[model samples]
Target: MTERHNAFFTDIAEATRLTQAGRLGEATALIQRSLGGANLSAEGARPTDASPAPHGTPRLEGPATRLDPEVDAAQATLIPERLRENIDHVMQGLRSLVPSLNGLTGGGQQAPGPNGTEPDGVASEGGQFVERSFSNAAGARDYKLFIPSPRSGPRPLLVMLHGCSQSPEDFAAGTRMNTLAEEEGVYVAYPRQTSRANAQKCWNWFEPGDQGREMGEAGIVAGLVRAICAEHSIDRSRIYIAGLSAGGAAAANIARAYPDLFAGLGVHSGLAAGCARDLSSALSAMRVGAPGAAEPGGAAGFGAGAVTQKLRVPTIVFHGEGDGTVHPRNADAVLAQAGIEALTPRQEGGINGRHSYTRTRYADDAGRIQVEAWSVQGAGHAWCGGSSAGSYTDPNGPDASRAMLDFFLSHSLTGGQG
Candidate 1:
């Protein structure tokens, strides 16, 4: 690797190690120094009596948690060494807490995935929870795979990406995807994002470097999917992916980067691709969402000098009206990428004994539900209708897992979207 590239990975690892050691200030500071010294701070860690946005409320700012890591020569030059030194304290802290992902990193061939199955949750059902690793030009990360019991014909594949500070086991247990995967005879893959990649293990959804068709995190994830397809008898046409928070954002970007590979997508509490250009924009997007998502091109083709291909995969989005982290406005952004604004929506929903939701379905000329979105009232930044055994789950909300799977089964690569 070039000196600059090696330095990039090294700094990422060091920053993450510091954050894991309860040295967040040092972690972000380390990142600032590397990225020409911007700044990082933790403020607004309390709620206010302020009114929420008419559609989706801004995520309540709070104490700085582990921030994401993203970098590249292009991004380094975008923010000069002297920048952010004079910005307002709150904006300084907000921008400081997030990282970048300009497209100028990653360029390696993927090594074969050498792995084996181990016993876990679905073992009794004759299934296997296997741990594996995928390394390429970008970097190396571990991921877990849940293979259902031996079935007759080919089965579908669902790629599950976890949010920050979560593991495959934790996400699997909370989402309860394994049991459902076995019951439905599907294969579930949970890709791991290391602290070395981001202190909080957040997918670098805001990074331009990570958004490219075959570079950085996006490339690694796509490469892994290809490897799995080669090794397993996966129903190539029924492959799908989903995630929460940062992972949700990453899933959107990766699916867009590889439209022909994935048939459908599910994003829960995540922003659309290109919604963020940097740390400050990322914070604003999480709060009230970035502007221009509903414009002619949507976020996929928005941003300054960043023109992306229109999203093609069928998508299902879920967000809590009460979530204070990633706002509900972002859900609209995600739907905008589905390119279904012209289609008439069939809306039908109400409180399900626990939480009220507005489910909107958009159909094409052929009558296929091209887009599906759910907004749960009184829900926070947690997975809806998820099992309490795991973390960040709201059991009272609608069953998102079941609903997403059904959406995936209904679509396929052959005719997912035009």
Candidate 2:
């Protein structure tokens, strides 16, 4: 058996043994360790050439916690047939035990209401939540909008894209963006990815077709933004986009493709655009950061002799130093891709009450802050300073959403309407 598969079974066996011995904490830790890097295909393995589904296949809408068929096939091939049933049983046991363990460990449980709103008991007084949809030639996507009441005038719009396996409500509850929006009088838009496009509901950032302007998911999201702006009194110059994980990668892709559409970009736990062109390369980039020199043309096909004006939109990046899924080094790669230069030495300390972080500020020739990279100490592949109400959040890290908003609000498009 390959070492990867061996390690997987070994960890499972060890976790099961620990659970049987009543050492729940150790068992849980073992399970979490095993889960990390679990999706990686075996080294030197290539994905099978599976044909696309028929055009009439109904698109699945909702949370995507299940594995994709391609991923399942790859995983199934790794394990021996005899061990498959045992692995499944152990996983089921872990799933049952995790909730109880979480309760003991003070993990927050999400209480989702109808239409992805908070439970009725929880008051949503300050802002109004509305579900909206946008369609274009690229595709159609549903989104959740949080509009603060009593708007004095045109307010800034913040486009939030959720990570894989996350919903708009869950993302909002975790990031607490709605609360911030109410305080700052900002409009928040959350574009939801459908399972029809990606089984994991992740933006297809690795696909070349999705990396350009007016194309693929990026085009669809931009269309949604335009529709939102047209419908609401929004400051087109103050529009911004931010996201986490796969969504984070998509945010960068959008910013690069449509720099005129956003004032700034925020990427948290995401890879740089054009870092990978396929699943294997993407996995490698996530595991070891992007290899070789940074991509030329600024990740948006803005090569020399391009007719349209090109601008390096302001960017802010946050990464957990201990992120096993996307290495922290990817943050530097992103900064480099954006042509941001570090102006000062890295500073380390507990900026918040939670995790200590090493922060570095970058600026352009004009001395304006163009990029800021924060490496949160002792954090995992989760949203920093996020509420436990959502999945993949670490409450013990600096508030990324607030920081991104502050950065976004501080900058405006140099010369663009929308």
Candidate 3:
């Protein structure tokens, strides 16, 4: 259809469909588009003066809609009655509530659709928050990318994965990675792990079927990374991956499955390989953590050894000594397997027997796998030096965020081969 006709048809469809579907905000958007296209007033056939009303006056129309001045001087004046009514009806239908539910009864109102992803798939975009969806025969996933304004030269991309039972916003706020990304000149993307894979919403990193080549969960992650790179001019050589717990394991899988795609991997209180060889082994490996044993996660008779054989990239490891979920021993073994020999600790005395790390090259050649380990004294399974606004967070140890960024920024693909 022609643009003009499309607008008319959209307005008609929106008004009819949204009213029936009880989605007035979307209907209003369609109406506005129609008015803009037809050069008519915002209220469609309804018209109003282009100029503002006199300073002391408030405009009113019959029952269609209403408007009233919000200031103190206009208490007694009745605003556009038709406009006011239309807005109220739309607001109620749209289910847009005042921020917070302290005042509203029965909690707040229902969002437009499942998980607030409207059937029409329209949501407010505030920042570099770009919403994109990807799907294949297996399933589909939705992700968001936050890019800073006035893009700088090709920037490093950090793929942030959310933990079990969490969404991208939940993970973003919990990690506070976006704040750091803004400070640094880097771009960050959050890939959501759907709940269908596991009831707990954990990434199925422990499943034998979850690893190797383009198959199962690994395939989904690879697809996401490829799609993101294709859509954005991401620095292919500077791409890094980080995740927490389940998400962390998924990050490791990504590095292992597609070593060429990622420059480094950050596993936070997460498991390694050899844990999910078979059904029973997968459970044990996931619960106990993967380390030392070769073939960290594969079938029982599938060979016994660590999965990290080659020095694909430098890795920064972080784990709390008091971690109850994933043992600190796993961290040590991962460093050893990845060939990261720890140098002397930095900042000797702090709350958790304070220590920051310095790493040397992975092999005899320079620019190979460089690794650092943060052993936070008495710290638990949490973000080292995380804010109080999140869970599984502790701020008493070396800041993991700064260290990871530094490691990621220091290495480049071409310069690493010397």
Candidate 4:
């Protein structure tokens, strides 16, 4: 192996030791330094020098989608067998320490059909699941809209974004949000990420162009929301957004870029807004959590001077203590960016205490919950309390869908202090 690969292995070993010794912060910093700053992509590619965009705008070249094989091959191939085993061992231990990184990346198992649908016994009998598409200046994208039957007046809308490699149907089945929406008399929308946008069908939450108001994916999604509101009798004040993993990260970006558009937000296994600008930093943020901040240049379409803001939307976060793909520490970083100084005493219980979790509520001085965090013990990257019919789900965990709905119902744009 070359000198750089040798150093990476050394850092990996040392990080493992530190993690075992319970010095996670030091290990994270060490790994960060060994990786050589933040311009690195997830696929181990370095960014080329490109002219910076106007202040508060994306780079002129946009985001890079693939890694350079010639540059990254050595790093990829030189990983010694022993070192690979050691890394796996370290990850297993870290999962125990973290508790939330339990499952492997992506949803756990695959279901059949285009939408990954199987008959769901728990799903409401008469709900409508309609496929729809919305377009704007940016582009057109497809989405699945679910409306519970027998709704009389305007209903709350919840936009659900799926993680990488997951479709709206898979997400709906996993989270069982549609069933819960039926019971709660809420409307649900699942916006799908296309392969043309991302090969893995993941939202480009890490891309600078996609992070701004009315710019890329965020803008497209916002347009979809407005169209939905116009067509359906949506309660604008009660509209909210939530997602898992990449979708969760995108939800954070959306809430940051368009705070007025959403009253509350839920992020599961997700990072905070502006936590990463490229794939490399995104991987780092997922592995070791980064401090959340807005990009330096203002987003193009929000207004002349409207920069991405620190999160002010009322929010709730759920992460596995052992989440290996996206570190559990990210939940804390999300709360910190929300300007939460302290949290209430944690309460513990889930599924009659069979699947234990710790919950803490962050409230404003007015005693309104601005943020809530749940750390599921022994849970992994999958959705806690999710169904097996869909991908990346942990049925034994508490019902995140139910909890999010309860939280969303309690807050609104005009009255709630998010």
Q: Tell me the lDDT of model 2 at 2.
A: 95
What TM-score, computed on C-alpha atoms, does each candidate reach? Answer: 0.68, 0.67, 0.64, 0.69
Note the residue pairs that clash in candidate 1: 45-62, 45-63, 59-324, 70-100, 101-207, 101-208, 101-209, 102-209, 103-209, 108-137
Over 184-277, each residue of candidate 3 has an lDDT whose tens digit, in order, gives 7677777655433454456666665566657666776678777777867778888888887767766776777777878888878776643455
Please tell me which model should have the higher TM-score, number 1 or number 3: 1
Regions of model 2 farther than 4 Å from truth: 1-111, 114-124, 292-311, 342-348, 415-418
lDDT of 4: 0.72
For lDDT, candidate 1 versus 3, the one ahead is: 1
lDDT per residue for candidate 2 within 26-105, as digits (tens), equals 44445555756233334413222233333244212222232222222444555545455555566677656654554332
lDDT of 1 by residue, 27-76 (tens): 45556656655433323111111221232422222223322333222243
Stretches of model 4 off by over 4 angstroms after superposition = 1-123, 296-308, 342-354
What is the TM-score of candidate 4? 0.69
Better of 2 and 3 by TM-score: 2
- Candidate 1 local Cα displacement, residue 254, angstroms: 0.6
lDDT of 4 by residue, 233-285 (tens): 99899999999998998999998888999999999998888777777767777
Candidate 1's displacement at residue 284, Å, is 1.2
Q: Distance (Å) between predicted and true CA of 72, model 3?
A: 48
Q: Name the top lDDT candidate.
A: 4
Clashes of each: 10, 0, 30, 18
What is the clash count of model 3? Answer: 30
